[model samples]
Target: MAEDAHGGAEDANVRGTPPGGRGSHISRDHAAGPGARGADDPKRMEGGVLVSIGALLLGMLLAALDQTIVSTALPTIVSDLGGLDHLSWVVTAYLLASTAATPLWGKLGDQYGRKKLFQVAVVIFLIGSALCGMAQDMPQLIAFRAVQGLGGGGLIVLSMAIVGDLVPPRERGRYQGLFGAVFGATSVLGPLLGGLFTEHLSWRWVFYINLPVGIVALAVIAGVLHIPVRSTRHTIDYLGTFLIAAVATCLVLVASLGGNTWAWGSPRIIGLAVLGAVLTVAFVAVERRAAEPVLPLKLFGIRTFTLAAVISFVVGFAMFGAMTYLPTFLQVVQGVSPTMSGVHMLPMVAGLLVSSTVSGQIVSRTGRWKVFPIAGTAVTALGLLLLHRLGVDSSTGEMSAYFLVFGLGLGLVMQVLVLIVQNAVSYEDLGVATSGATFFRSIGASFGVAVFGSVFAGRLSDRLTDVLRGQELPPGLGADALKSDPKIISELPAALRPPVVEAYATSITDVFLYAAPVALVGFVLAWFLREDRLRGSVTAPDATQTLASNPVERSSYDEVCRALSVLGTREGRRQIYEKITARAGYDLLPAASWLLLRIRRHGWAEPTALSEHSGVPLRVVIEAARQVEERGLALREGHDLVLTEKGCGVAEELAGAREESLAELLGDWWGPDRPTDLVRLVAELNSELCGSDAEQPYEESVPRPAGRVRPGR
Candidate 1:
């Protein structure tokens, strides 16, 4: 379960709005206006929010789990359905449908409403799951998987978007971290779970298991999840989407069926190849003319984006290809059970998790990222070479060692690809560039699975035919039978089993051998990737949260908000207040400055309301209010506190100071040449930063007076 690159891209799509889009309204509502509602509003009830979030997480888990869970069960599935040649289609269909449908789901949710759409997605996913579990043949299963993937894509994109509606910007990072944790957990647990169900119950359980989880998620969402729907017109790139999907379909078909189902130079293969090329050209043309392109073609013009995309594709090609075939190798050739194969794969999973975490931390710390991708691709190539050496007689220790190496290599590169793409693009291209990077990785994964199947099938056929030629005396145990059902090898006579196992081993390992050079290509391209200074937002500690999840569809505003939220959290409250006050040239306590900014943001605030909303002690808030009033910075009108003329000037100065500080942290991203959307984003974020009570000064920072002589100051 190499990280689902699709998740990262799709997550980005619906999380925020485009420059002049919904994000502007949200920022204005949350920050710049008197009508701004606090995230801690009593009407919302914290308990209900948590429950709703839990339901959303469950929905995301179902989508993500399916990506890796099926790997361990593929062997049993092919065995049950008897279509070894179509094994890759099971994975390819899901990926292809999900990838193509991701942007559409995001747009539809935006146009309609996410809550209802999310419910619809769940129902669709559950229906698809039921159909998959009940599938009687390989074609039916593959078709059902496509149905499942369509829903799965919606589940991933909308769940994240819905979180944006439920929580304020300040808390988004913390919750997105939860989503990242889900992806991380699934990466390790999916294969294991699939193995457990396939071994203990049946392979069908892998699909059936989604029914209960999806049902609960659907019910909870329908019952409790409520968010305002702001209808916006969107011109979806329908022609572009169709052309690109057709292009991918044609290419995948050409790769998967070219050598096995049809000859490489045969009419069908040639027609697919020619059709893919024509569709690709047509897709490019349509993208140029589309009002809102699915993937902007201009992204390819940037050197860093292009290079990162190439590396991402190659990484996906190697990672998924290996993940898909490794289980078959262990179960068929090494004679390990489904569950044991999953257990044995843990070394690789552990290696990937460790390396991904370590690499992300290092990048966050130093702001230097080129080294990881370069080293990762190189090690990946080396790891694949190591895996190619695995054989039927290979020791468990040796096999584990190779798997760990491959996983480490993959981990080192996976997270950095998105960061570099984000850094390389301008604010305008930020959302698309992020999505584009992961999109290529996903497409690469589809191609990898398809290509590997083609190679494995072709090689296994030739090897099995050569080894078992003229020696099969059994009734129904033919070469095709052995290919269709690997279980038959165990039933083969003792003398014939050795050569047959050798055939399977050589065919599977040869896939790794062929893939090693592809990884090497990534290693070479890695050298060409431009090294750029990481943006403060991109290098924030919680940045990994953004990268680890399924991030496919998000807007530039949401992307920036999430990153800046992490940056704001990382920079403690006291320090941030101190910096703003210093920059504003105000000689006041940080708490007083915080109070002025908050009052300015909401137009008016009562000291009691401020104390209650922000977790600061009432005494401390009254004291700060006293100080501001003493300075004539704010005036008391009945029970509400409003900034005076001078206080308004000071608050504006402080707001400007906060914006400047944020801009400085963004490096070159902020400046005279900065995009208008970015300028708006920084302003909105400044308001959000002040609006959030989570960043209020600690209770210990301002102690209560020994004498409690103040009722209303």
Candidate 2:
């Protein structure tokens, strides 16, 4: 077993080694773990699962927050750095680097290990953040921001990848939905936080704020996460990585520059477009020949994956396009402060939070998920259409309703696409598949932002000219200046300001009108998506089957499976509480009871671990622990905790009660005379959240009696 586990495999294609020169070398043994099933299976909770997940989620938030946070601080940054001509690159640089590095990071995580890669990414992000904060010039700030993006991209992708490792697909809905909610929350929070920091502290604080929070996350992940080092041998496709990065850079440049910085037909724009195409072609050609492709071309062959990618792109396009202009409509047209405009966006974020959370829970409960995207994209298109109808006289409430509809639609579709793609791919391909989907989305956002910027610029210029007619502007003011310096419009003479504000409103609305068709395309694509079953088993995908196949292990496996499934549900939690209450000879509240159990289970734990493991507040855990200690249930010896004689008895009783409860829950439903395949039955029940077994790999048989499309459902 050790020999197989330690066997070395050569990876001659390795590139971009860390400073320590850790090359891409790995080995694996069947006795240690087998297949993607083993690799992707949830690691057994050793008292800190929630903590690890929380830390990873926070890290992802740092990445997501930076994307929007910088927008509010950009004007200040330009003023400080004095490079008005190069202003757009401040944001574009980060977008460009992030988009370029995303796939490379995903592939590297797959080649090595996710935990280490994630940690490295976070460190790089922090370093980049520090440099950005200290940058003296626009050139330096932009360069450092790109550095930040390299790490930021990895953090975003790797966080999701790690979640895949931690939770089975059947149970990932809530967590993934929560991740979506975080992204949505940050969309509103980032700008608000940025404005606060910029106004109260300095624009540099926007980057500096990541320092303490990121350090906490980094420390938590380093201490708690324990992904097994799987020895695997694979070549890293350096050429493919370079080609893909090159293509992404070119595409983002074109998207960011075309018709905004340069005219659409200009040589610069045309050259970048042609170069992007050439690099894309080259990337595809290289992937075909490489030992390991950054994005496996075979993924496109899967209908669901292909469809999801397309829909993700379209969703990003429409969503970003609308978001890019919504503030303009609220602030420039309606004459609200930047802060108030952000406040006005709250309805959208609220809708997103509610819809994403509710939809995820529903998907978890009932395996039917196809309806969400179909309805979501359709609603998204409808919302965009409504926004298109907004006039200069539209009320705040009217705009709020429009934002809510649009946000709800976005929320429903965002995480569901990732779920669909993950469901379609095998465990080994999870990271790359996710990164690929995100790459499309990121690129789509780039295109959306660019194209909409062009549309808004042209429309506003024409509107301003038409509105002004023969009227001359103040010295040093023109239509072009108004487009660039939006604040100047509010300072114009009352007669002139009304026309400019109306013109701004018209231009922004036109962008939304143009984006409505993109959502419609996504709606069409959502219809073509085939819903597959989510994986429900917490262990290796076929662990249930393997145990059932062995006659000697059948009875024991059945018991284990039943116990796990029961414990996985809400009612199961009630059962646990009852077990503890019954054993302790008194009413132990949920937090106190859970803390005692964890203490008993782990022998000793810090106060933080107890809180984290049990999902109790730290203050609650500390108070409960103190109360228990005063009652002679637990005592602290030095820094370690130990149970007394009474405590041990209570622990023993709780354990017995738990066994009894499991036995009762898994007991025969029908009379004992007729035997049932309880093991298979429990497995099926758990897997049911994933839909039918039609899409499961052939080797993993999901047995069903004849003539039932869905047997238990």
Candidate 3:
């Protein structure tokens, strides 16, 4: 790792939680998006959580299933069209259209509605599948495949981003398990189904199979995914779209042709690569200037987004690119049938599913995703090195064991990165940020696959050339066929077999050896990922849940959810403190108390900052400070937010109970745009609850009970 990166992680907030306490619970339901409850009523909030889970499952399926489904069918499709050499295109075309379009799709989902756009994607995917089934040849099939990519691209990102939108990262882990399950099941199952269709039916059934499942998924999503609709319109970034697509296509083309179809020094390859670089630079410039930029350039300035994006790109390059070729090696080199290859590939899928699900749940409960990724990336690097050492003679057990290790590493890190990235942004930016990560991953994965395929093919050809030069090769035995299949090389003239098989093994191993440096990139990024508490207390529509009734739960939930917000994280807590104080009149203690309580409940800070922050009179601040110290909650250490272990627990519980008291005191303060006076009044009520004097202007509320020092006392 770079020295700079080490410093960055230290400065960054990626340290996981501070020993104890979880993420503040906030209502992640963004109004006017997919699966939102239009009302902030309690019944609706409860209903929304239940109904939305089912819908999210359906959406996740769209993303995960699409990625794994086409692999088994690729070889068969190539066979039928007599274009085995161009087989990588099947996956490339899908990734190309999907990745390039990801940002646009996410933006539209936020603008229109997640449900509406998601529904549209499902329809589009089904249509593309239908067209693919009817294709007469390769070109037609490729065109239709691009359509499928469009829908598939949005599937994973939208679902994940929405989870970040609605659920706090800490609590979000449990549900994220569902996404892991879908990905794992699909990865294992897709190949088996694809193989069956290729072997028993036709290669076309792989595409056709999506129709029935697609309909069921669409129905589930349309009915259950409910978000509020903003009555506003947004201008689409057509120019941004054109630029991104152009750059993506050129880069993909260059990677695809680099060593296979054309030499690196060839004009076609050089020109395409240059064009891609220029277009990419132009796209960045356009994004920086666009009014409603398809990619939000500002998001990159944030620490979490930057690290998450880099990690996603590396994962795309290492995992996606490398996995794309696993089946080929099994079938062509080892003489394993397609069906057998699917069975052999199950260990990786199994490992990923188990690890991701557990990691997600642990993250939700502890809000410590930073730790898992660290462990995961380290393991993944080790697994890649092991896999690289495998030769043609390596047994199935050895390869499968290596696959398991790699899968386990991948499972731990993949979805958790998405979880953290999604949590760092506000609901409004959730879709855009998520789509950005997904878009980059798609690009990286596509480029990786193309590059590896070209490199492997070229190395094999070169190796074969050297071997053939000294051999009395049969007049009809061509190097092209032998280079592609180790089994074919094994069947060649006995004297030539050893050198030929060795060449194939070397070519394959070189891909991993080259990719090791690339895989380490994610490891470095992992160190800088933020360790903010995922909010378990973020509630949007739960205002209607009785504040007086569940005061403890309400307070705690509110604290966890809003602490990050109250702390001036996006904007700065000091500013918000001043704003609330100014609006509340000169009763600084009361005003400060309200702000501090809000911040504490959000679990983003030590609650004691409230007393010091009151800036009321020293006497008034001291009294409250004494009360907190007596409770053994928070204490002052100069100006820093200092706390004992006991204090952290107190702060965590305080946030949990605060909501009920708040609901009872400020029953009328829930609206998108309420009077500023009401905001001031809520602050006053909050001050009273914490026994501070920063009351609202012209208020005569009952005072806090005296001599009530709650323990850890």
Candidate 4:
């Protein structure tokens, strides 16, 4: 819904496949982190990995920036292209194409490998951008945008998924935090950048700008990126995907053109309505029987998933509708330059960032999420009502205040919607539920833009007609010309300009007034969402995951891995080691158990290196090594500690214990009938945790126990 760039992280690897093609059962040898796939792996090389990450970030930026940047340029585009009635189509087409293509891209990447798919996606996006820049008409631009959306959707999904492939679970949060920061920055910078390009350069520059960035990303990715490809058989739900897309298209068409483009009762609108109904029924039938349904029909039976989906749709409807038209109101009626219009929208972006961050932190801490959505929707409705008060003479300050209120309301709801759906569904449903929630939001955005456009176009036409009933216009100047381009008002007689400006202002404001009821619907629905105890993974999501604007498109395993990674990071070395040691029920100190597991994972652990890397004191590392050896768990070979046969057994037991402990946090998700993929995830995560130096146990500056002898002594 936010045109979030990192949608594909969850689907980075094929779901249900054992990580690295290891056996289905947990193995002691697999205890090494998946990051250790190959010594020559480019993703593991410190410098090369940075370069690769930079390329991925650039790819994500190309996609994300396009989503927000185009909004500010829409007014200029329509004016130049002379088709105000088709304005919304430009945005709707992109959203529709991207939303429909997202899952397919992710699945294709899993099948054919992401690196090649990623490059292909980049090329497609660049081609679309080039075509869009060269377009001469509204229809051409709209069609080109859909082409762009197809590639843009893949860029977002694959870039995020590739992160999972490139980074181990332990260090993933740090990098993902970077991705989240990018999303946040784009939210503020996108419109501003669009405004600058439109005013200083040309509207065409907005599309052209992506060319240089995307080409660089493509080159860098091709040269430096290398990830293993594991192909697995998949049954893609082609029919379900097509039907859903068709249904959404039909509904959006009805909303956009029903009253304005065609009479509401006209045959075209009636035909589309009936077609949409038929498509909906067909989609359900296809989904119920499809091997891998796009939107699993069973999820609707879950109350939380259903309610969250609806609320998400409403949020998307309200948020995108306001975003699409606010620029037009500022530039056309308020008489602000395109660049200044972007500047004036900052309050709303700031409000959204602040509230979303705060609400996420609060929910993570308190585990009560229902209140935010309820309050958010209520405030959103209020903000819409406040926006309705804007007139031709509304001050910049008044507009900023109203925008901030509206943004604050949106932020509170957006972050929690995914979390709600994830917490509600079973392990098998986690991935689809997350994607489905965002999918609804995306469809809502398409509807909102279309509906808002219809209202604005119809009202503007009627208002201009009423006000100019008896006015004498310059030769060739008419209401139609004024409707096509707001700039045409400047050519009108000085007396007529006032009525034209007022008409533009009221028509746009009335749209907000009409949309308030939509937000109110979300408010009422929020009251019905049942508050469940938060899963540990959902409790403390990485800052990037929490603050990111896009829907987190990940499989169940990746989602759990990410959550566990965050939890492991937040717990730090000492706490996690203590818990795992206790769960292991071994007759050894936590430090000694950690040493054995570490040695077993890597074959050997140098005491000094261990202390330096893990922040465990040199004395403690030596003492732990000595203890393991005294217990015959490990043996000293030169300066490194190597696991003995008994040590290997103990280490495997410790790893198993760690896996069980991690699985316990999932609650019902780890039931007896848990999916094998989840079992694989738990095992893989345990191995990574044990092998990662970043996760090695650390003790604060504390003296060793009195009974423990110095290693030399």
Assess each prediction's global lDDT (C-alpha) against the native: 0.81, 0.63, 0.59, 0.81
| Higher-scoring candidate on lDDT, 2 or 4 | 4
- Cα displacement (Å) at residue 508, model 3: 2.7
Per-residue CA lDDT of model 3 for 1-713, tens digit only, reads 01111122121222223322222322324211345634444345545665676676666665556676677666556556644445566777887877666656656766777667777877888898899899878778878888888777666546654554554322343455455456556677887877777778887888888888778878866766665654336677878888988987888788777767887899999999889889889999998888877777888888998887777667677777667777766665565777787788888777776786677657755667788878888878877888788877889899899989988887777667656765676544654665566556666777777777777777777887888876666654667656433444546877777766677677777888788777787898799787876644222111111000000011112322232222212222233333343342322333333433433433323334333333344444455455556555555545423445765554434432432334332222334664454344333323222212223111124343344433323
103-160, model 2: which lDDT tens digit per residue?
Answer: 5676678678989999999999999999999999988998999899888888877776
What TM-score, over all chains together, does every model reach? 0.87, 0.65, 0.63, 0.89
lDDT of 2: 0.63
Error of 3 at 422 (Å): 4.8
Superior candidate under TM-score, 2 versus 4: 4
**After TM-score superposition, what is the CA distance of residue 38 in candidate 4 from its true location, in Å?**
13
Residues 244-348, candidate 1: write the lDDT tens digits. 889989999999999899999999999999989999989988999999999998888999999988988898888888889999999998888898888889999
Ranking by TM-score: 4, 1, 2, 3
The TM-score, computed over Cα atoms with residue i paired to residue i, of candidate 3 is: 0.63
Alpha-carbon RMSD, each predicted model? 7.4, 15.4, 15.0, 6.1
Candidate 3: count of backbone clashes, pairs at least 3 residues apart or interchain? 53
Where does candidate 3 have its weakest 10-residue lDDT segment?
544-553
Best by TM-score: 4
Better of 1 and 2 by lDDT: 1
Model 4 Cα RMSD, 1 decimal: 6.1
Which of candidates 3 and 4 is the stronger one according to lDDT?
4
